[model samples]
Target: MEKREHWKSKFGFILAATGGAIGLGNIWRFPYITGKNGGAAFVLIYIGCCIIVGIPLILAELSLGRRSQRDAVGTFKVIKPGTGWFWIGGMGVATGYLILSYYSVVAGWTIGYFFESLLGTFRKMGSPQAVASYFDTYSASPLKAIGFHGFFIVLCMIIVIRGIQGGIERACKLLMPTLLGILLICIIRSVTLEGSLAGLTFFIKPDFSKLSTQAIFEALGQSFFTLSLGMGAVITYGSYLTKKDNLASSAVMITFLDTFIAILAGFAIFPAIFAFGLPPDQGPGLVFRSLTNVFNAMPGGAVFAPLFFFLLIIAAVTSGISLLEVITAYFVDERGWSRRKTVLTMGTVSFLLGIPAALSFGRLQGVHILGKTPFSFVEGLTANYMLPLGGLMISVFVAYIWGGRKAIDEVKVGNPVFITGRIWVFLLRYICPFIVAQILLFGVLSEFTSPRVISFSEILRYYLGIIDIVIAAGVIIGGAIYIISIKRAKRREG
Candidate 1:
């Protein structure tokens, strides 16, 4: 058997993992979501969720990967042997591939926009409408959209085929630092604009009153979503780590950097968002449409606009590499394919499959699945259902199936100092799984509801009522009791 590829340094592992977490959402969605929900109020909620909800779940997933020393599918198969648990890993791999198909297409648009920005394509865009029109025109063009998608996927393919230590580690070492540097530059420029203080105040001040029923769930979703949880990206990345690294510390580092970059991205955009007096709740095109307008309107925007878009493209590339790595790792580790063969085959197939999604905004515009466009349907299904289900299953497997002692042992693999094991287990066993299950259940129900576009808060307020709250309370309290009982029983046995 070929030796399993491992990261050369702790920094590489953290960078690779953080690269996976920092994606298009961190750049586009986070800032806008923060602006709309309660500015800094929602950010605090998001941070809290990241701590309790994200860290535990990802640590569990990473522990599984490192312990099993295999891809997601291979990990379950090795650990459980004869059980159906491997399907969780299977689901992760499949979900990653499906997500990548469309995700690459969107990533491609960022690259396309990067070039256009450099070329000063949007220099003359006077209003948000003009920028919106520019996005519509490019996205609706079948040739342009597919071409860009193909380009982005190919770039990822090249990196993955070069193997872990050489390509992924090296790319992230370059990419993550560059991404951070660019964000800092953008934040400085944005915060210094004439009307930027209002934006700063709005982002920095936390007013709890903005907490609505939807905002709570939105924060929950973002916390998980932003971290690349539930999708096996962490699992896949973790499989490559050296056995000497501490899982807990690595997870914390990745989470800290991911959250930091997200907040930095918010600073970069929210200040501009307030300066332009644009609605913070503007939808997904915030980057392509609204931000371009901000760039066109800002001082020295012609140059900075391109730099910002370039950073956006790199952000997309880093995350896309992770998504692609999830898929590539499975084939290479489980199916025994050569890295080159797997990369080429999967890359070709995924790029071809992505063509439909590329056209979804253009040629396939009107087509809908469960009331979502082809592209949106793919995203909604994976993010809401597959990812959450995968995360829930990972939590259950680690906390219950594998047993608490075993999990603690896994977390303690290399580190001499370890205090988070017990609390992390509690969160994974009790809080994370139940909450993710709620996300999964709600995600499914959303498809049938009228207009099919109600918020999580709305879903909870009306149809579900206090049932979600009651369930969550029951799960947390019951979980704490059960864990205590288990430990006590073990102590008595000893």
Candidate 2:
């Protein structure tokens, strides 16, 4: 097998990782979740979770890859020889493919909106009904969505085929900074609106009374999504990290940058919504319709609207590059294929997979997986189930089977502070697994407990939901306890 290469410079790694962490999840999903939850209170808890859980998991993933010097599949095999943990790597690759399939479709929306904003189409739009019609006409058109998705996926493949330094790093070096600069300008403009202060207050002020169990779960889910955790995306990127790189500091920097972008995006989005009297919880429609209207009606509407969407497209594209890279790397490293072959094959597959999502708006609208909506069902399964399940496996593999204390030490390398103390172990052994298990169980229960008029054809949906939760809970608890017991025995023997 040809030996894979590490990033030539630290900045390259940072840019690529930051690109992965910052995406539509920040601009599109984060704001709505914040608005729907207790705003700033949820934001605060989310930041806390990002620091405690996100940073540690990131370091662990990067350290594992750097130490093993292999992509997701080979990384586990190399680190803990003969262990079945490599299956986690396989899951990561599959998750990446799943992510790209739907994500390309969403990215298509951003691209379409970018052009619309540039054309000043929103200026003539006055009523919410007009906005609804605009979206209905454009967003539901299968050909338009497919064309943009195909374009976005091809762009991603071009980057991956160019190899790491030439394609991925070079693009991020220009795109990430440009993304931040555009966001800051938008934030400044957003805060100048008449009702901006109220928007800020809504986002910053913690209303404990508004927080619910569902809100807490939502926060957890957002944190996972925002950081790109549990998708094996990070682990695949981590494979390119050099041993000299400081995983702890790098993880912290990426986390901080990701959080900053999310908060800044809130500042850009919410004030505009408030000023225009638009509902904040418009879900994905918030970006497609609501924000487009805001840009249209703003002072420098023509110029700023296009610029905002352009920035959004760049953010989405950078993240999509990471998603594509995960599967591409798996093929190249594990299957002994050329980079071009890997990218072309994966890109074609992803493009074909995305068609269902793209067509969900038109001719394929009748195709229903479960009784629920098609897009929603796909998003729920991947985001809610596969993501957390992947995270659980990662935590167990790093904290128990592979390296354990050795892994901690590797993460702490080149840093003055060490995380190998009992406190770190306690969280890895107890808190992380416990939180993940709860999320898994609640996710399952919520699916069943929700009122849905069911038919015999849909009976399997409810049964699978129950079975998924049971198995997930059992695996998480079983793995955590088993690992802790082993550590105790090792200590006793010493």
| Positional deviation of residue 237's Cα in model 1 after best superposition, in angstroms | 1.1
> Compared with the true structure, what per-residue lDDT tens digits does model 1 show for residues 98-148?
988998888888888888888888886665678778988999999899999
Please list the C-alpha lDDT of all candidates, in the order they appear. Answer: 0.83, 0.79
Candidate 2, poorest ten consecutive residues by summed lDDT: 453-462
Each candidate structure's TM-score, on Cα atoms with residue i matched to residue i, is 0.92, 0.89
For candidate 1, the TM-score is 0.92
Q: Alpha-carbon error at 184 in model 1, in Å?
A: 0.6
Off by over 4 Å in 1: 126-128, 450-494
Q: For candidate 1, what is the lDDT?
A: 0.83
Q: Pick the candidate with the highest lDDT.
A: 1
